[model samples]
Target chain A: MRAGKGLKWVTLLRRVADTQDTDAFAALFEHFAPRVKAFLIKSGADHAMAEECAQDVMVTVWRKAGQFDASRASVATWIFTIARNRRIDMLRRDRRPEPEDLNWGPEEEPDQLDILSLQQESDQLVAAIAELPEKQRVMIERAYFGELSHSEIADETGLPLGTIKSRIRLALERLRHSLS
Target chain B: MITHHLSDKLLMAYSTGTLPEAFNLAVATHIAMCDECRARLASFDAVGGAVLEEVSEPSVTMRADALSATLARVKAQPPVQRKVAVPPKDDVIPAPLRDYLGADGEIRWRSLGGGAKQMVLETSEHATARLLFIPAGTAVPDHTHGGLELTLVLQGAFADEHDRFGRGDVEIADEETHHQPVAEMGEDCICLAVTDAPLKFRGLIPRLAQPFLGI
Candidate 1:
């Protein structure tokens, strides 16, 4: 699965959110900061700017720690959102309107079983992406990482969807021509 | 309860942070109302998380002191969220749209004739977004779309030749579609409408007024 860290990142995030623990924060930063930097750079940030933005994102992770809900989102998913918003802000792109919140802040803890299942779903998703053909995998990376502009993104409603794809099915069909 | 959810294309674009601001507003506003779409959005977001978590070797690295700097930054800033389940407000405008409308959240309506009015929200150059008001028993002038148009009903209901859209329903129209939407009889209807291109009107009066109406 992941590296030598036996503890879940959610556990680490809980420590950060509840007690402001440095060791936990360091563990998270060590794991996530590099990836955030790499993601920003792929999204068209310069080396220096990506570094600064990654730092800012980590700080936000610290600040918004209490908002993380394992029942709903994995730590990587949450951090990806934070990094995406930071990219938009730093690039001075158009304001990204967030969907209305169904609920605000963290509430009661989700069932541990629910948390485990969601993380498993996320991990399965990662494996699924890894198993995709190289061309398909790159297409996904390009779309999420800012290589495709909004207009350049495909919207062909007529293309067929295979049963194997998930919610991203149509988006994949739309991204088909971009690679060519 | 949202029957007409956003297309997977729109939701995935939103999840990837690639949609125009206007479209983003439409999607977010719809999601605020539809938990199904929100759950769908979360799945799309997992794809992003998957991409981020994919173990590609980094060509770039964060400076060694990155964690220290982040910790320092957090010292001055308290954890900024207190998500205490703020009950959805009674106002017609949802939270994301409220920010763009009047600071008091009052919609300043401009007349579009036939008991329909509109308030265009300021978005980027990529697209146009507006709130549309149609009194009960009124019909918008017949029209077709040049590009994509997304309409999400917020209050009351409306029916066109295609289908009936109620609160939290999103009806998407593209170039080939043509319909005249009439508000359902029981209540005045309010909707959030976003378009990538201007609408084409068929009626002589509306055609003449199109230059001034900005529809």
Candidate 2:
């Protein structure tokens, strides 16, 4: 069940990639489409547009499943990139440039150990962010959600992230003590 | 080896899909040549992934037919996107940069005087993307940025008040930076320079329309 619980989305992607298995694709959609739609909505798309784009993103997910490499990214991270790119295309008139493919041939098979560590790291990263003080967490979320202007992002981040993280912690602790 | 790299803020912006198209192109080209930035970018991407994973289930659900509809579309579309035709690879220019230059990576450069030349790549209105060629020992004009500047060295190298930027290196300058960059001795320098605002030329009359680097 540990294996089953740890984003078996990775394994499911393999099935979808190898056999065009609709079952695996359905499972992925069931888990991610709503989140993708919400992400779009939060990023300022109207409901109708977000709904339509979510489907489009999921379809692209299935289409590009063959290119997914588990060693480098968790399934959620991979899907997030697809959703983000689709959002960019929806919002921007200009073409977005993407980094070149790592190589021309087939995506090399990810090592089993590498895949496990990546998934673990992804899980831990999510938990760590979840634990951030509201002020700190909101800033990050705002940055990712496009709530902050480019200048605001640039100016606010003048301090190193580690410095800001500690500042937020100290400020939050002081507030907590005052309340207590 | 790449000595300079993109800022964390810029990388996060790239991961978040908030950067202007020109900046995106510059960052993409840099990541193609630099693995350290590539790894940093992947970790930043993981944050987005985590956001998607732990996000509260939305109040709204996927339309009932969303899956079925997607499957039907899948039947119509091939499992893989048709490969974009691969142009012959340039030994120096990276793939994403090549994609924008289009067809053999040929560039037509306009003189910027002082043996420095530039070709502005067409990008969205939010920013300007240009390629600069400086003969060895040539000096680009002194300028300060109105907003932000990101320059990635593609061939040879250049040095300014800050440091030497070599192939795969990126130099990020903002409003406060004021300096002149001279192509290093030996090979000539070729770089992709992007700016979010007009470059304020120091002590030069502004050209009619070329607001960047007093072209």
Per-candidate TM equals: 0.89, 0.87
Q: TM-score of candidate 2's chain B against its reference?
A: 0.88
Q: Runs in model 2 with CA error above 4 Å? A: A1-7, A154-180, B81-90, B102-104, B204-215
Best candidate per TM-score, number?
1
Highest lDDT scorer: 1
lDDT of 2 by residue, A1-180 (tens): 145334588889888988899999999999999999998888888989999999999988988888776666778888889888888878863466877654222423445665665566666677778887787777877777767655666534422234222322333233224333
- Report the number of the highest-DockQ candidate: 1
lDDT of 2 by residue, B12-34 (tens): 88888888889989999988776
DockQ of 2: 0.30
lDDT of 1 by residue, A1-180 (tens): 242121288899989989989899999999999999999988888989999999999999999888776666678989999999999998888788885544333434445555665666666777778888787778778989977765555664221222213323333222222222
Q: What is the C-alpha lDDT of each candidate?
A: 0.79, 0.76
The positional error of residue A85 in candidate 1, measured at the CA in angstroms, is: 0.3
**lDDT assessment of candidate 2:** 0.76
